[model samples]
Target: MPALTKILIANRGEIACRIQRTAQALGYRTVAVFSDADADALHVQMADQSVRIGPAAVQQSYLNIPAIIEAARRTGVDAIHPGYGFLSENADFARACQDAGITFIGPSADAIELMGSKRLSKLAMIDAGVPCIQGYQGAEQDDATLSREAQRIGYPLMIKASAGGGGRGMRLVHEPGDLLEQIRTARSEALNGFGSDELILEQALIEPRHVEVQLFGDQHGNLIYLGERDCSIQRRHQKVVEEAPCPVMTESLRQAMGEAALKAGRAVNYVGVGTVEFLLDARGQFYFLEMNTRLQVEHPVTELITGLDLVAWQLNIAEGQVLPLRQDQVQLNGHAMEVRLYAEDPTQVFLPQTGRIDTWQPALGVRIDHGLLEGTTVSPFYDPMLGKLIAHGATREEARRKLLRAVQDTVLLGVRSNQRLLAGLLQHPSFISGQFSTAFISQHFAEHPCLHPHVPCAEELAIAAALFYQARAQAYRQPLAGWRNNASVPLHFNLGLDEQQWSVALDAVPGGAYRIQVADRSLALQVIDCDGRWATLEIDGVRQRHAYHLHAGQLSLFTRPGSLVIEDRTQALVSGQASVSCGTLKAPMDGAIVDVLVTQGSKVSKGQLLVVLEAMKMEHPLKAGIDGVLKRLQVRVGDQVKNRQVLLEVE
Candidate 1:
């Protein structure tokens, strides 16, 4: 061991907490670096020592190398573990850490620099005799050159950022007409997400399986592959779900891919935990995808089957220790799967949502790596990935079933999430049979019924919400303020959910009962039991129970379908407009306007990109709904907008 004593985790959220867990378990003192937004975060509380680096924005905080180095120096930390994302793959950060006499808990700066660029990595892999996809990875990055290369590489091609992972700076161009625009968008995203705008074009594999091999090496020139993971299921070019021991992989194929990954690692004298991703086709052929120089988000699955702690290995390897397990001894057992839980609305094209989580409850019988707590404010300064939910089983089906149940049991109120979407994916038939590809989601759930079905049981939800509200009111109100003796009068409520409206009248009956009438339907309800946050009720003679939380005039009901947020507009009905005209386009969520694509009086067609709003580090384009001339643009570039705030009017 290289005299390692103290270590600093230079990241935030669950990742920082994850590294801290391993370090603390191994009898090492851990330090946490946080931004202004994460000052009171879970990771900060879990660390032995905490340091505030900078502001909320990532560029000024997590990616601020100088600030992180200074914090490490002040804290007297012996080493720094980047813990994926931020500056994990940054060679300059590693070099700076080395110069500061602080050990960086990863590969050398030269290895990071070599693998950080896709073009350079592809060249290295090709030189090492690894199978690479046929494409243009040249230095000429002009529009004309890229367009010619796109045509030469054929219609369906992928434009990928040379620097960074996580599908941030990636796009697929299907035809010639969309190539230029996609190139521009990809370049813009690349420049913003990574510090580099250089791109590489490759032949798009048609729905191939994304398999990756885990690699571990030590300073003694020893390396071993820890089997493989199938990460084919994706959305927006990023992995959504992952599993180990890819179903179709035979022993021969696994050995082949494993050896190829080992070759790639040996090419750079790699040391530490890394992953070499490959795009495997239906014909059992695999092409080299870029290598990740840091620990992966889905490393838990590999650990579960191998029965080894990858983080501990990384720490020991960083300390110049020999490989703990040899290639012949390392073995895989059983199966493992992991699902990413993101704070995004899959129905809204995976738009990132940010708000205070009034109620947060993780699932049971699963391993959850999260940094969430009740009342935690999920800000828009970083990634929308809340955490990961992992499950292990003797077979894939058992693991899938366990994960599915766990997803259903998870309770998160306030912000919209992909919880329902994840459940849908796990239960999908294609996913169950192990025949899924990268296009699984788009093919099956392009327009699923669960997305937003006709206002989401508006009448039942309205009645439940009103009753819940009345229960809270009774806790502090006059005994008969909302009750009637003769059952002649009922308490009335008008609510709005998105654009849908409801009018509910609830009559108080004996035994704390109620008769509810919403629109043309009438039903009976009884508050059998209530404990502030939960209510067991009899609706139309059918018994049902629900958990609820109310905040800021909004009631969130955790129902079978998921958390249904309803705005109690009973008071607003008397003063607010009955309905606003649909001429203006409003912001769907809180975000900053990055680009105003259309100006006043500009004639725009339906589905034309009119504005671009960025939230949680992802760009979302707000398009025009109807063909009309832009009459007024309310917001300019860089303006922070609230949910439902009108951005522009088309009339």
Candidate 2:
């Protein structure tokens, strides 16, 4: 292949920017392709040139092969890099790049085709003497065959999409009764997400550690492993935290796993970067899962420990260069950990969030890979992961502490996120001791305080009240700060948050201090300084600073518990209107309606499945909140709906 001078990144968001950074550093001009929604995205601005591929939808944009190739052709680029996600693991995409005379900076299309399917990859691994779980990977994909096979495999088996990864198109069936339903759902999801509904079954390993070995190979028949990462910290089968050098890995175990991973790579003549995932049980036995045929989202941890840039290595390998280092020469340095910062609401079952980012303050002394500006709008057209926070240290404890502080200090306001949950998990005893598995979140975080809805405390309310008062005083340019016509009377204000209201009274004291009362608690507050966003306050004699953003009567404050949004409703009119009936069902977020389980005039129970909305590449089933007859249905199976739009009405 000719030297790669100008490369076109056929993706968007952080990964695109990440690849561009590395490519530009290596004297390679980079081109970016984006959808209509991402025309003003950070990645587009960072690239040397950009092309509009298609509209906001993935099928018409990022996943549109012809459009991506045409963009590359139009830009006169020499190579095309499909950064993870959209078409990263797509074999046809790789082949198209190869056919278009554009070097595909990845493994061979044959390798991608072989390993993209869980079923096919497992069969090859078994034939190559690699350890694999006992299950069914047959060609008969009929529901009856899958059900019978499930019976033979016993209860507690995993239904996995052959052409899927990233936790999609997968389900765990704990009983025989739910096998068929899970298989159907998994197949449907797999079909929609991967264009193939083929599935495989395997015995679910209980309390197993999710470990993966990073492998790199070249066309010169050389392959090596760059250690392993423990991705056991996950939720809904998606990884939340990843770290390099498995915590419990012994020298022998590492060697065994690495050799097995190399063997899997060699089976398909893999080149460039790939990962072999496995399930490491408590007994030191590991079984092959599937192989990811591109740079992983968790690759930063490996790069930090190995002291090598994987993307640069990928570029060199794509240029037909030999492996940068041999298996024995590979050295694993200190410790490194990374956490995925997602745009989600922990209190609302981790639902993906979308809105304009009002404030973007990344933590110092860490590596943050994200494509976000202060005013960037996070749309619902893609994944919810905003970026990653990575920390490297001489020890695991150091890395953990640094990551915990980063999670707390990095402020992202104007939208809900899982910041508190990430902080809690980082400091939790189980995580601190490195004693965790893939079941960590599901087993322990269900009722954890960090995941619960936060009700603002008296101190927080007082701080918000003070900020609100200061904003009003500034708005009116009060001649005398906190001055009142009636000196003996106090100022009353009402604040609202999360549908709850609080009435607070503030009494202006001498020397620019105020005594605030919320419910039964009273505190003395002195605003040392206020700049509209950051404020220094002496509350009850405790001097500290806090971050806040006030816009249109809504004050977003960063407190000890988490980010809170308090609305100043003191001047709002009091309405006697009744609340909307519980029978009304609305779309939780912007998404396409994929399934309508009930028709108009159908009798539905309180918990009956009403609709399945597909958003952020996941399916969410909307259930009826009250028992009633379905009086109206306003959406069909392929209708795109907006957030809070009424989907149905039950009378």
Candidate 3:
């Protein structure tokens, strides 16, 4: 495009801010597009200008091509950069950009179309002599064809959406009995998430390492691989942890994978930045996965090691600039690792969480890429990923340790997250030794203590109680706090946490200390100093500092294990209302009811799927908690419901 001077980021969240950082540094005025839900998002604030695209829904906002093109036109931008996800890989969106006379800082539409579909991409890779898993990628996608293919492919096959990525529309079936139902579920997820219901079957590669090669190409046919990243640490097919220069990679294997990736790129005449993923087995054999036609979320690790700005390269290539470095000139440096910080509750099957961010204090030693503020609300309208924390060191162990410390030190309260899980993973012996695969989490940590719901220990409870008492005393200016007519008398308090209640008694002692009793445990606690948000406490002769945020009668405290939210209900009146019964199924979070499998009054066995709720772009099957009749059905397909809203009741 005529020496592009202005660019519009056709995306949101951290990726948009990431693009803006590079584009603005390169002297290009940037434009940001936002939906109504993201009006106050950090990305919009960072851009030189912004335009409202549509509503909160992805179909009406980020995925709306015409609106984005119109945004570019109105901003008078010369180029548009589609960050990963949303319309990044949509061929029609690329074509729309080209037709609008705007430079699309990515590969051609034809290339995207070819690589976007798992079936077409696998077929193309096989033709290009790249090793591929034997699967059914035929054009015929009927139930019979899929069933026959499943039998031929044998048991333990994967049913994947042809146009899916990030784990959506994918399921692993272990036997013939579950094939049809899985196919139906996968198809539904695919159609909802990708606008396509095409299905593909692949032989499951048990415990394979999911590695990918980053490829950068120019208009002059100069393409080079920026090393590879090991993304085997995944959950539900979505990558959680990624590190550069695959942990088990040798020079020969790296070269082989890099060459295969280049071949795949060349077959489609690829340009700009892209990634070719592969499944590397234990026997040193690798098979082609799919190619992502945009910058990846894990690109920061590659950048940290190579000392290169991939976004700048994309902009330069789009402006007809030649590759900055040839394949021979590229160099890979030290080790780097990254962990995605997701707004999810790991103890609750990693259910996505949404709430206002009361505190967001990122660690200093690591590089944090996020779009968060103190008051930012983590809505359920988008992905649960809050941001990423990346660390670089001269050795793999150093990187791992640094990342682990960063994850522990970084404070993010208010909403539930997987911070503790990340810390545990980093400290695991298998992960520390780089002896893990995609099944690592399920195999090693399935029953790990960190995954279980956290109950406040004596120390944690004492800290919470002391902090709460101090805050309340200071707020009320109670000079006679903990004072009683009899010096031996103790102050009584009640606290609630995780739907459980505890009665605590605190006795004032000399030297500003207190003896706190929680259940059968007693703690000698003393609040050394407090500045409202952070407090240093000494419990049982051990001194420690914690970050805390108290709001709306709830105190969110960051302990050594993770974040704990406690409420002081000492003065509140007890309600006689009964709690929700086990037979009542409530919406776990805000979501739309996608399927109602059981009608009212229908008999259902325990563990039967009753409803499927689509939230955070994934389908969560709500199963029967007990065997009973469906006495009441309060929701149906297409009905939007809020968190804790009762969906049905089985009596």
Candidate 4:
């Protein structure tokens, strides 16, 4: 076997750290590659050696092929592991590694090329006898053709990018009226993301279970199964909560799926590790979804139950190790569940949140994979996934409970997370009963939404704290603006949180502590630190922590990052279950904003164009969200926004 003394992790964040742990345990050193924004990142500091890839933008750095290969050569690393996403499945990158005499810790270039494109993979699966959803893969970017296919496959069809991956490049057409536009949009996104606008049409499965099997193969031709994970709990076609030994699976079904996975693997002459995703309907019928050729973010669930370190096996296999084990040798034990802690706003359509973490840590339970430290800053240029929290237990229920308990411990003081939504799902009766489907999160949670514990009452706990900080700030004044003199500035302040707003009146109480009244409650508090970003205070015998940040001049309390609790002090301004963001022009899908039509102080009438955003290298006009004078343009040309964020606010 080729000895892998040093492995260069061509990725960042939790996955890099995760690889380091396994490589270290196996007596191998790790090399981490990072972007400019990651200079202080946890993964960079943890690696044995590090290399700076590029500026903060992924195009100039992490996704840059030449940069990755050069780093490997400079570091004298033997192999490169494209953890997941980014360049993980790029066929050209794989071939580049091979040409450079560097082992790519993944499948052969041909496998990625064939399977990377949904059209070819589906053709291969059809020939190999794997069941598939009804749809057409061969076609040009013609709307008429898509409309006809949508009619044949029937309504409720899914438009997917043949060359697209991630949750991007795909959309569902529930009715005939929206089929053509959705297809056009999906194709554009697919082109923008994967550089190929190839589009495919498939029948959308109702009540589908996003189950996938973990498959491994050696150059010697031995293949094995690591059971399956029920990742049915998903948002935007991406998994949120995953559990092992699916609560409704049987041994017979396991054998059938395992064999099918091997067939697909062998078809591509697969190497290293890969995941074959499938969509299983409520009727127990299953169809091929796609093959993820690189290590998956959710690999931990498979490892937890199968008692194997997948990353280790990838390194061994890439180094030309022979098949030391067979399918029968693999075993599934216990139960496992994983929750993704993202720096996102769940209550507001999962908008990517960027800011420094004022307070919080992902809870530990059996295992958790994260890449940020206490003071880490989440950047908008990368994926918002901060870390993953996983738990192992004897039963699924036990694991579910453990995962919930772990989420409650996140004290993320800055930014917002979807933790509360995750907790609600964990506690929901359907979730506990294993009755959840891909539609569960959007259909149920989005409507009712999960509510976290009411903010600590304005009693002696929080109010006294805010007051103390205000007092402390006034006291530490360089000129000492004594309380009496600073009275004109309004010592009374209002802090807005999500769901509830606080109006606080500050009063000095002797010593360093101060007294304040909140919503009819009064108390004394000793403030620890007070800044424009956060307010930390010791209250009511327990240390209570809270964060305050400005969003469009409106204050929001970012209390929990691990949980998706974003308390908006502007809650009163926001009524109904919906959020009232400044009028925004959303990118129909993932695209680059180019040629902002209006600058600061430009006014346009209704239906007037304001910006030109480009996707798939094609220009798209961003119309005004409202008929008002445009002011404060936040994004410039070439800026990237995910899903929704105000592009140009009109007043």
Per lDDT, the best of the predicted structures is 3
Instruction: Kindly report which residue stretches of model 3 are placed more than 4 angstroms away from their true locations once superposed.
Output: 478-487, 509-511, 580-651
Q: Which lDDT values do the candidates have, in the order given?
A: 0.85, 0.90, 0.90, 0.77
Provide the clashing-pair count of each candidate structure. 0, 0, 0, 13
* Model 4 TM-score, all chains together: 0.80
Please give the lDDT score for candidate 4.
0.77
* Model 4 lDDT at residue 334: 93
lDDT of 3: 0.90
Q: Per-residue alpha-carbon lDDT of model 3 for 479-536, expressed as tens digits?
A: 6664557868778879888657889988877666999998999889988988978998
Q: Could you arrange the candidates by TM-score from highest to lowest?
A: 2, 3, 1, 4
Q: Judging by TM-score, tell me the better candidate of 2 and 3.
A: 2
Could you give candidate 1's per-residue lDDT for residues 1-651 as a string of tens digits?
557889999988988888899999999999999999998899999999999999999889999999999999999999999999889999999999999999999999999999999999999999999889999888999999998888889968999999857787788888899988988898899999787899999999998999999999899899899999999999877889999989899999999999999999999999999999999999999999989999999999998999998989988888888897889998889889999989887766676889898788787898899988777799998899999999999999989998888887788888888888888899888899999888988898888754643365644564565555565557565774554555586777777776777777777656777677777777777778877577778777888777778666777877653677777777763521111234678887799999987789989887788888887798887776678889898999999999888888887
Per-residue lDDT of candidate 2, residues 202-268 (tens digit): 9989989999999999989999999999999998789999998889989999999999998999899
lDDT of 3 at 45: 97
Off-target runs (Cα >4 Å) in candidate 1 are 142-152, 176-181, 458-466, 472-482, 517-524, 538-544, 574-651
Q: After superposing candidate 2, which stretches have Cα over 4 Å from the reference?
A: 478-482, 580-651
Q: Give the TM-score of candidate 2.
A: 0.89
Q: Write the per-residue lDDT of candidate 4 for residues 254-332, one digit (tens) a residue.
A: 8888888988998888888889999988888889999989888999988899888899888888888876677777778
